[model samples]
Target: MIRLGYPVVGVADLTVAAAFWTAALDLAESPEWARDSWRTLVRQTDGERVLGLMLSDSAPEQYPRIHLDLLVDTTAEQETEVERLIGLGAQRVDWDSYPPDPDFVVLADPDGNVFCVVDLSRAPSGS
Candidate 1:
């Protein structure tokens, strides 16, 4: 059976992206594969990698079809996490696609990669 691997994010400045992501996710750099243009971020709990950052000059998609969702159990947690991410250089995205009573907040990383902070507790049934 095939298993899902880490999501690889394209970034303009690998060093800055690496620093921001590591702090945001509480992950650590994988020293074994660390480089100027690429870095792997590992989860601190089990030392398993969560994602890979690759250097790229291309601009981030204005409306990416694929984006990461950081899940939190409650709306309070989601709000707190959003604030923390903003403090870590992430910017809140003024998204226009939200439904009524939305349970997620859109945000962008330092490189303008879009993602969401989702509150699972507020999700509709069977979602």
Candidate 2:
């Protein structure tokens, strides 16, 4: 049976991207699969969920249709994590698509790849 693998992100510089993402996601580089142009980040507890960073010269998408959404338990946690990510080279995007009140905050990585930090506690039960 075919199963889903890790999500691969395009980056202009593997080292820089890997560094930022690994720290932001609290992941570690899998040395066994390490390469100059590619790197895999895995969670320490169980390496089931992984993120792959591949070197690319193309520019990042300003408005990517597909992006990662990081979930935090509480609004306070979400705010703290967003600030921490910014310190690690993430930029807060002045998103124009948000509703009057949004449960998620959009941020762009060092390479300008967009992602969101979400607080599900504030969302409706079925959302």
Candidate 3:
């Protein structure tokens, strides 16, 4: 009855976050980019529903218990991606929820919304 969709990460400045993600994921903003308050709303090449980088003026409390799962090929590669993300605008976080031998690294976006980069491992080597 319900279909999952791309996730949104709210931010204080859409343009800043959009710039970061455009570099991190090598994606470009949609032609429909609002150029205003919704400037951060972006679409991937696949035409997935726009992922929002909403302004902080929206609300408090992290919504929906959602975090974007960015898939990489290996944990070592994931580590490198984490470093790259840090260079982009991410901060490392202590995600106790994940396992010891994690296939991903948990981190927060520019606005502090958390997400994880997961390695596309054949076996569930880690949480």
Candidate 4:
């Protein structure tokens, strides 16, 4: 049987990206996986590895084929979290392809990597 591994994100500056991600997601850096060009982040309370950041020189795509989607239980929480993330250096993206009643907001990390903050209470129909 095969198992799925955690997602790895490419970032131009690993230290800055690590700082933003660790604070934004309540994760902690994993020293065991530390390297000059890469860093692994784990859950703060459980030490379960959740994400990895790899050094990359290429620019982030305007429309990435894959991106992270963070979930919040309520619209209020989603709004609050989006603000909080912005306080931590995230920027709101002016997405052009939103549906009539979208359930997620687009945000870009400091490195310009785009992701979404989804409100589960308003998730798209049939999703």
Candidate 5:
């Protein structure tokens, strides 16, 4: 099987993006990188993998089509997080759920990268 790695995000300012993710995901920033341009973050509950965010000197001209879908414990908290992100320049493109879906919300990051806030209540525990 091919190894699919965690996505590394490119941001204008890693510090700002880091703060947004920390507050939104309740993740702790890792001090592995010596420079502010590169930073690591891991969730407190599961430290299996880390998400990397790097500072980009030039912004992406095209809309970022790919994004991370965060499985959330609570939709309410996720909503709050979404609001916080929107406050920090993240855009609200859409919020949608089909009949089969339990719960979820869609949002775009500051750079137009679209992602989903998914409710994990339906997932098998311990996954």
Candidate 6:
């Protein structure tokens, strides 16, 4: 049997990405897993590894095929989290593909990696 590990994001600058992600998600840098070109971020509450960052020279995709979706219970919480993430250096994406009434907001990290903040309460009727 196999188990999935944490998501690994490619970033242009390891230091900057590490700082933003750790603060934005309330994670802490895992010093034991630190490397010259890699960072491991773990949950502060339980020390469970959640995300990894890898130094890469390639640019982020404008429309990434795979992306993270941060969840919130309510639309109000989603709105607040979006603002908070922007305050932490995330930029709102001018996504042209949004539905007429989208339950998710698109954003890009400092490194331009795209992700979504989804409101569970506003999810599609069947979803």
Q: 125 in model 1: Cα distance from truth in Å?
A: 2.0
Assess each prediction's global lDDT (C-alpha) against the native. 0.92, 0.90, 0.72, 0.96, 0.70, 0.94
TM-score head-to-head 5 vs 6, winner: 6
Q: lDDT order of candidates, best first?
A: 4, 6, 1, 2, 3, 5
- Looking at candidate 3, what is the lDDT of residue 94? 67
Cα distance off (Å), candidate 6, residue 28: 0.3
- Relative to the true structure, candidate 4 reaches a TM of 0.96
Higher-ranked by lDDT: 1 or 3: 1
Model 5: residue 11 alpha-carbon error in angstroms: 0.4
Per-prediction TM-score to the true structure, in the order listed:
0.93, 0.93, 0.76, 0.96, 0.64, 0.95
Clashing pairs in 1: none
Clash pairs detected, candidate 3: none
**lDDT per residue as tens, model 6, 1-127:** 9999999999999998998999889999998679999999999999999999999999999999999999999998998999999999999999999999899999999999999999999897883
The sequence of per-residue lDDT tens digits that candidate 4 reaches over residues 1-127 is: 9999999999999999999999999999999779999999999999999999999999998899999999999999999999999999999999998898899999999999999999999986693
Question: Which scores better on TM-score, 2 or 5?
Answer: 2
Question: What's the CA RMSD of model 3 in angstroms?
Answer: 3.6
State model 5's lDDT: 0.70
Worst 10 residues of 3 by lDDT: 55-64
Model 5 pairs whose backbones collide: none
**Candidate 6: global Cα-lDDT?**
0.94
Off by over 4 Å in 5: 1-4, 45-48, 57-65, 73-81, 84-89, 94-103, 120-127
Error of 6 at 18 (Å): 1.0
1-127 per-residue lDDT for model 3 (tens digits): 9987566676787878888888888676775656566643444667555576656675423433766888898767887899999999898886667766666777887777778788887337466
lDDT tens readout by residue for model 2, 1-127: 9988879999998888988988898898888678888888999779755899988889988889889999999999999999999999999998999987889999999999999999989877883
- Given candidate 6, what's the lDDT at residue 51? 97
Q: After superposition, how far is residue 13 of candidate 6 from its true place, in Å?
A: 0.9
